[model samples]
Target: MEFHWCKRAQRQQGVAIVEFTLALPLLLLTLLAFGELGRMLYQYNSLLQGSRDAARFVASRAWNATLGKVEVSPDLECMTKYVAVYGAPSTPPCSLTGMPANTTVQVTKLAGTNDHVQVTVSYVFSPLIASGLPAFVGNSVALNFPLVATTVMRAL
Candidate 1:
């Protein structure tokens, strides 16, 4: 009779909610972590694209000595507006608000060499829900992540 009962228990061995319950948090955490990482990467890519576009735009324009070698100075005020296509000041939770203060666009012209433009974008990121694994010192606080993008094009 005991052997019969043991055999019956073996038939039901795979039905338990405890296993799933234990795994639920981990699964959710993985999802959130992936989501946050994806968001950060997307933003970073956008900044890079913006930098590239800006560089291309500046390099293609005919250098005007009256204005400057690179016409980027007057366009400085419109940098964010210009970078809109690349997701600057657009993405949620990481909008233009995310841009670091005192950001600058540096342009360098090399005689007979490719002109270089550097755009430095910085943002603060915080851990997403159920994903506190990336916290600094395990503290739930916002941390700044600098995103730098550079592009070079043949001088016109």
Candidate 2:
């Protein structure tokens, strides 16, 4: 009986190794997915904060009390874009050190009874792995997506 039990255990000795091998790829893929998700969220948050900061900067400076509207000049527009992208109104060549290349910022001033300033920041998010993968579902679906953050504040 003891000899038979030892033979059965020996046959199963390599089962755990096989199982781990089978699960390794899935585990790695899951970890990659989670890391990508975290990166996306962090980028989105940065964009949102940038948009909000740009909006505030414009609203504080662009308001025209006499005209009853925001007055964003071409220079101000340029500065606002800089603020959104570089967190400052610095002159070029502004270092976009860690930012995505496709990032864009648009500033719009709405003329109405209650004028508002709108700042929009958009960035293209490309996953580390999925960005290079061919779309299996045709052209309708893309692995890369755009993340946009918009902030609207009353001109003051």
Candidate 3:
């Protein structure tokens, strides 16, 4: 009985390693997917906050009490874009780390009974794993997606 049990234990010694090797890729992929999701959420939150801040900046500065409407100028638009992208009104737009090159910011002043300023920031999110995922339906779709954040506030 002892001899038979020893033989069985020797045969099963490599089973755990083989199972782990088979599951490792899936486990790593799941972890990477989760991490990518978290990073995307964080970037979206940052973009939203930046839009809000830029909108507030424009609202406070672009208001024209005499005209009864928001005055949006070329310089103001440029500054607003800088604020949304770099968190400040930079003379020469500085590069923000982790911010995509295709990021765009638009500032608009709505004319109505109560004038309001709108700031929109759009960014393209590119996942770390750009390709290699199998698509069962048809063609493999690009993983890149857009993240847009908009904020509107009454001009002060």
User: Per-residue CA lDDT of candidate 1, range 1-156, in tens?
Assistant: 999999999978876776888899999878877987898788778767766766665555535566555444444424433452443333222223344453544555544533434344444444455333356566664444555666666535
Local distance difference test, each candidate: 0.55, 0.85, 0.86
Q: Which stretches of candidate 3 lie over 4 Å from their true place?
A: 91-100, 111-113, 131-138
The TM-scores, one per candidate, come to 0.57, 0.86, 0.85
lDDT, model 2, position 23 = 100
Instruction: Kindly list the per-residue Cα lDDT of model 3 for residues 7-123, writing each as its tens digit.
Output: 999999999999999999999989999999999999999999999999998898898888877888887788788889888885634333454477988899764645798999999
Q: Clash pairs of candidate 2?
A: none
lDDT of 2 by residue, 1-156 (tens): 999999999999999999999999999999999999999999999999999999998898898888877788877888888889888886644443455479988888764545699999999998877656656676545578899999999878
Using lDDT, rank the candidates from best to worst.
Answer: 3, 2, 1
Instruction: Give the worst 10-residue stretch by lDDT in candidate 1.
Output: 87-96
**Model 1 TM-score relative to the real fold:** 0.57
RMSD of each: 6.8, 3.5, 3.6
Q: Give residue 151's error in model 3 in angstroms.
A: 0.7
Question: Which one wins by lDDT: 1 or 2?
Answer: 2
Query: In model 2, where do residues sit more than 4 Å from their true spots?
Result: 91-101, 111-114, 135-141
